[model samples]
Target: MNEIGGWRLSKKLGSGGNGIVRLAQKGEQKGAMKILRYDSPKARNRFHDEVMSMRLCADIPGVLPVLESQVDPDEPGQKWFVMGLVKLLTDQLSDRSGLRTVVQAFAAYAETLAAMHQLKVSHRDIKPDNLFFYDGGWAVGDFGLATFQGKKAVTGGGRKIGPIYYLAPEMLNDPGNADERCADVFSLAKSLWVIATGQHYPLPGSYDLDHSAFRIGSYLSGERGVIELDRLIASATAFEPSRRPSMKLVGEELRAWLAPNVEISMPTNIDFKEHIAAIEQWQHSRARAAKSQKVRDEAIRSLTNRLSDYLNSPLSNLKNLIEKSLGITTTINKNPKCGFLELRVEVPADQDRLAFIILILDLNCESFPAVNLQGRIILEWRNKAGFINLIWKRCYEFIENGADEPIKIDTLRAEMTEATLKALSETLSLIIPSHKIEHKPKLVRIKVHDEKGDMLSGVSLRFIDSEGITLAAAKTANGIVEVALPTLKNVVIFVAHGSFNSTVVTLPDENLLVVLNGDPRSRSMICGGSWVSLAGLKGELAFVHDEIEGGIHRLYVHLKELSGNSGAPGAVDLSIGKPVRLKDNAGRVAYMTPRAVIGDNYLIDFEHAGDL
Candidate 1:
């Protein structure tokens, strides 16, 4: 242990070329003390400047507050200062916290930098090591290399400051004439990049000032996710200082990106308590409610536009696959009514028959409790052939607890939109029937190909005449199907094998080739699709399709044991969409229906039936 002035230094925290930081204690209070190692006039002057800068910006939101400053009275040369002990941002990262935490930390850091710039102070060393977490927010520490606006460089000439990897190109090229503010901006952007994607800036060891911008742009263009953030970083790191925005502007932009609800300004001094109170007051106010409602409405509108764009874009590969694999053109009709978004999907089955699926997405915020919004997605579709209706309803909750500032209600809206799309895709998969046909007799030669244009063999083909009678059924051995003509007229063809299915009508002489794309194995199976048998259970288990009371089809399961030696009665457990455990008292499991059904089912085979 060492003693500096009246403070007892119990442990060393860190050390650098200029100073060493130690965990210090004064009686029962704990803090951190940084002591200068060198005793020269220049070192004393720089230390005194840091002390003054910390004192000036102590009240700023993100700047670390100084606790005590002391000079050696006996030596008349040694100097040291104490600051509030804080957890380093690196430590927070080592905990493997979520990306949302990282984003909030960076947002607070940017706010602090903006506040410092407003007071003409530049934190020359703005890196991860200099950032700390104090009182549930991030604060900037280590002011050893800080500079004030309009001040001359303390290091005489041609000496660069800050970490090498984060130093702006201008600083590296012309150290003697570098702008401290511009370098601070560039370093801040680099810090943000590191926080967002657990990686350092890609452009390192490339000091060519003229081509640095191109390298940065090219690197960012290849990156995915967080699209808006990438654009901001590219603009902030422009090679020319004049092209980069001010720190205040950068902070504002970052706040918007992180959470649109948070509004921060460069006040002379920020009071955390007052700021929190303001947020709480705004959260319950009529104005805030209106704003939140507006955000939800905007999110709904944006979702509609995105869906439309997806339907029309060339990259709508899912749409193309669905159309080509099902042999049906689907159309979406958007209907907005009473704070609910309704989308109706129309699929034509034949000249006289059609199917409709309706999806109702309710995003009303006022219907839920205060400080939270409940989003409900109701999916219902009716198949004309069986007059069967399948309905699924899922609800999601979005919370806005006033402390969730910088995280907007619009984010909740986006989440709701994503959930609705996923549910719609799942419902469509279950309702779409396998291939069926009704057409006049004809003679035709047809070929089939996979999405890659490769010929597909082992495809099963079924042809039906206009009188709803199967004319021919065969499996292609070499991706080709030929049939003799009853007449050169229209014929309905159903092509299927495994999970693939398609229905089409064509003349006998037309050159026909069908292309299959989507993997039907990925689609969820509905109730009446197929039944499967399982072996090696306590009894013989099988899944059968059954129509329930409300015109809903479901998978019914039954188990029976025959010619088995009498053993102690037990229970057989089975899980499909839900869990079911049947007693073996009667040597059989009665027929039962599950709560919900989705996806494929599998059964394991074992040597002994009781092994299950």
Candidate 2:
């Protein structure tokens, strides 16, 4: 026996390139001491990393602990650390050892690795020989290549670091930049395959299924498995590092292997009726999950187009409406800013991209998410989000967090249209001393009428200042809406109808006659699918689009002369995505631009679609 630090070293346990492990005993305590055999800088750094890493994981039940060590790796003579003596995990899952035992053991090992990962440590050199069973729990030992995430790499880049067979492809290909935690997950899973099959090691780049070992028990999967565990493992072992699950998720998945969705014993214990009810509930839950998954898949598929829909619809309307109604000439720079779908509205006022309204919707929302991607359809719309009081609303149409799922890009053009217009209006107002009307307010009567000189009822009117903010709003019942204002300079009034909103510049002293072009009773607040009388056309023209009746995707439209200018109602059909253009028999036109959320999930219906 050789004595050092009052501990007597006995039998040699193992030997590595730079160190040797020996059984050590100090009175009643027994441990394994690893002594450095070289004085190179690499060896010294390796020891330092090992000691520091072991110190961090000392309290975790599954990780091996260092009792005492030469903390300073540069110390003279032998650098050694003593750890609890445990048996190597090699051959623990021998052919005779049931797959049950292999599953139970590896599942716990997964938990241990998870604990290490939670601490941001990756035992980069994990292998069956590095794992040991002691104190009725498994402990992973050896931190020569262990990595502290986000820290400077101790070893040089571009070289394979771990054992060849258990090495993650990324570690083999790009060791320096490879995500250490994900690499560890790969190595651990590969090690599981090796042990479960009782093979010396797995064939590099080969799948577990390709090899044999009653590996089906290891194929364990469900909620975490869905055969889900199997899928998770598949993903964890995916060639791409990004595809792998985090250690925490892998650990949860491993534990889930032991849980049954419905215990087999439940039917035996519960009464017949209860058993039947349980089966029905279970079946319903599964069906619901499948249905939800289908909906989610369809929505995700629409994400790219939804992004385009935004640009073509609300954002397009915003630019046009601002120029026509608010008198602010603007342009939309449709290019992505920062790899994100950015809708930046610039006004001619500055002749530069002043960002009059910037809505940077995440093109890849999970990468560039929308409304926080879940429960609420939130808008972090440039600093102007707060100006429109009612612009923000819940995205119940997309995200449903009964349980939880990753947020998907499922927003529609119709869903965001009204909000976008209101926000644009409010935001544009901030730039308005353009109306330069400097006068005190006095009593004035604003008479509302359609383009035909017919008195228009139910027209909502707003009195705005030179600064472009609404000072007051009044709805008309007798064709006249009265408000007090000054008559010295010109006044700007906003006329609002359900589907039509216009900005009018007038003098407060004279009783102003405001002409609204579109119908006041539009079904949609954002557009006029409602009736409209064109300059040359006598009958009010529009279309009534029916909801989809079977699996049909085309829009079903019925053109009618509601006031009896009289031909029969013209029934026409249009495709789902293209803009709708309906021509009455008299050569009169009723054009409707669709605002439906069209995608893989559904081709939208026209109950409340389009503008005149």
Listing every candidate in turn, what is its Cα RMSD in Å to the true structure after a full C-alpha superposition?
23.8, 22.0
Candidate 1 local lDDT, 440-556, one digit each (tens)? 454568888877787878776655443334566666767887776565432445555443423233223445787654332211111223433322224444554343464344444
Worst 10 residues of 1 by lDDT: 602-611
lDDT of 2 by residue, 186-263 (tens): 888777766654566665663432222323333322112223233344445767675565666556555655554564
In candidate 2, stretches whose alpha carbon ends up further than 4 angstroms from where it belongs are 91-97, 149-153, 206-229, 264-612
Give the Å shift of residue 50 in candidate 1: 1.3
* Per-model TM-score on C-alpha atoms: 0.40, 0.46
